[model samples]
Target: MRRRLLLSYVSLVVFVLLALELPLGLSFANAERRRLTSDAQHDAFAIAVRTDLELTPGSIRGSTALRAMLSKFAARTHDEITILDSGGHVVAATAGGPALGADLSANPAVQVALRGDDATREIEASGDDILNVAVPLIAGRDVGGIVLVGVDLSGLSHRITSNWLRLLVLGGIVLAVVLLVSLLLAQSFTRPLHELQRAAKRLGDGDLGARVKVPEDPAELRELAESFNATAEHLATLLRSQQSFIADASHQLRTPLTALQFRLENLEDDAPEHRDDVGGARREVVRLSQLVDGLLKLARAEQAAPPRTDVDLRAVAEDRCAAWWPLAADHQVTLETDVPIVAVRS
Candidate 1:
């Protein structure tokens, strides 16, 4: 039963940890993803300001300086870059694609750019996030083109997932520590309980001396130990009382019975035909009287409430000894008193 309880407690701890960890780690990942997305959008907005007039790929023609700068920008950011012309066609793309004549008018970002709306659109294209920012390029008072940028979620989400695994590892470490501590505490508590159980079983099987070893730790366990000791103490006391009662009852009846036996032995042997019958009657009478006295004493001890008196048991023994002194002298038997000075059982 104790083992089951321990398992239950540990299970509850695990369940709660899972309940807390799953959602918390997922939220952390999502928060990081949001930060990544916002940073990507901000970078796209910056590009839009710089490319407000031409689809010249943030540079003039295929300038080596422009290519190097673009390469550096790609190396430093997670956002994907693309340029579109006034015809709503892709003029250039960072993914090494011919963006020169690809129609972009039907694209939501192109529509936003043509309408002179600085707009943004997020779409999933082939499992990649296309965060299109349609900021119209203005040439003197007219729109020239649109600059579109995309940020892929797969890579950023992978990073978020990596950090999540790390969090789970830390949580596992914490859970291990908790379990170890619980184990030590449970052993400390259950050991005493197990001992008490064994002791109780022993007492039930008539070993009244059985007792639990008191625990030193945990106040409650110590209290249980004390309670067990008290129970054993009471049981021993009751058992001793029963033994003393039996011994007293037997010893009390022995005296008069021996006397009656002696009287029976002294009956005449030379009597007539009626001698055997008369002798039997007298012997039965003596035996019956002794039995009656023993029964009466037993009945008195078993009463719902016994009489209480200040009778000194040893003093009573001494008085009985005095009464039998003359008889002991006649039989050449010595009378002696070896009673203790202190009080004793009745």
Candidate 2:
């Protein structure tokens, strides 16, 4: 019972944690992803505005300035930047990026940017997760070039993983505390029941004084214990009253049975022709005395509440058969005994 109660408590706690934490973790992950994507798109558009002013038609003077700006921005933000001409060929890029003059038109973000629209996507490049944002560079009502920004997502993934781990650890702590509290609660509930069980066993074993202690808290259990105690007290009082009555009745009967036997014995000497009658009357008086003795013994045994002991059935049978042999011989009957050597609690 205690185990079942504890299991139920732990199960409920687990269900509540799952219901609350699962969606919370997912929401945090999605929000983080969106925030990072928005920052990347903003950076891509900022670079596009600057690049639009740098690369004018038939202007070679701005090439050095553009490369210097791209390198500085890439170094500070740790993002890869690539500039593509209107024909989809890379003109300038950050160090370790796509080579200059390399065609990247087949790239989805590049293709979308070439169509004069902004594009954002998440992709894997060189075994690393990247969030790519592309925007068109406006050059006097025509597309001058494309500005592409690739943001590394390893840090974001790490942040999300760290948060999830923290949540898991918190859940574990909560579950541990719940398990301990549940264990204590279960014990508190079952301890009273265990005491009641022991008391009932004692009462069943004839210890009529056995009783349970009522608890102060938990009104229902207290009431149950009180009821049990009341029942036991009433039963004990009834049995004691019965024993007293049986004792008094047996005492009252013994005097009459003894007097009857004495009168019958005296009649035998006074009348020889009535000897048979006197003998029969004397036997009946003896039987009555034995019955009274039996009743007294029963009352005393009830008060004593003696412990049971093992008795050998074969020994008992042999003793009884021997004691009854003379009576059987007088009746012209033979006494035979067949008993197995078995032990039983008396």
Candidate 3:
């Protein structure tokens, strides 16, 4: 019972944590993705403006200066940068990026940026997720080039994983605490029942004094315990009264039976012709005395409440037949015994 109760409590807590934390974790991941994407887009627009200025019609510098700026921006932000001309050819790229003069028109973000518009997308590259932001460079009322920024999303994934781990650890701790508390509560709740069981067993074993102690809390259990104690007390009192009555009745009956047997024995010598009658009366007196003795023994045995033993029915029947043989003969009744041996617990 305790295990079932504790399991129920823990299961409920786990379900609630999953219901609340699963959505929270997913929301955090999505929000992080959006924020990172926005930052990447802002960087792309800023680089486009700078590239347009550097590539102005009378500029003294060439692609060397543009490459240096792109390399510096890429190094500081840890992002890959690519500059593409309006004809869909790469003009410059950071180290470890696509080769310069490479055609990238087939790329979705590049295709959109070449048409003088901003584009953003998440794509998988080299077994990692990459967020790409592309913006068009304005060159005097015409599109000059495209600025493409790629941000790795491994860090965002790690952050979200770390957050989920923290939530799992917290949930585990809460469940552990709940388990401990529920165990204690379950034990407390069932303790009274255990006591009642033991007391009932003792009472069944003939311990009239056996009783349960009433608990102070949980009104229903307290009342049950009190009622058990009251019932045991009443039963003990009743049995004791019964025993007292049996003892008194046995004493009262034995005195008169003994006097009657003495008178019947004394009358035996006074008349020879009435000898048979006197003997019969004496036998009845003896039977009555034996009955009174048997009753007293039964009362004493009930008080002791001894453990049972095997009794042979055949032996009991033969003894009963022998005891009533004379009475049966006087009544002209033939009592025949054909008893079978059977063992029974008493």
| TM-score of each model, paired residue for residue | 0.65, 0.80, 0.86
lDDT of 2 at 6: 87
lDDT of 2 by residue, 1-346 (tens): 9989988999999999999889989999999999988888888888877886786773212298889988988888889999888877888899989998889898889888878899997889889998889898877667778888989899999999998998899999999999999999999999999999999999988888899999987999999999999999999999889989999999999988888788888889999898865776676677678878977888888444566789999987886676666668889999888988899998
Candidate-wise lDDT, in order: 0.69, 0.86, 0.84
Candidate of highest TM-score: 3
* True-vs-predicted CA distance for residue 227, candidate 1, Å: 2.7
Give me the displacement of residue 212 in model 2, in angstroms. 1.6
Which ten contiguous residues of candidate 1 have the minimum total lDDT?
A: 53-62
Over the stretch 165-206, how does candidate 1's per-residue lDDT look in tens digits?
887897789778877877877887788888898999888776
RMSD in angstroms between candidate 1 and the native structure over all alpha carbons: 13.9
Residue by residue across 151-264, what tens digits does model 3's lDDT show?
999999899999999888988898899899999999998899999999998888778889888999999999999999999999999988887888789999999888988887
Q: lDDT for model 1, please.
A: 0.69
Q: State which candidate has the highest lDDT.
A: 2
Worst 10 residues of 2 by lDDT: 53-62
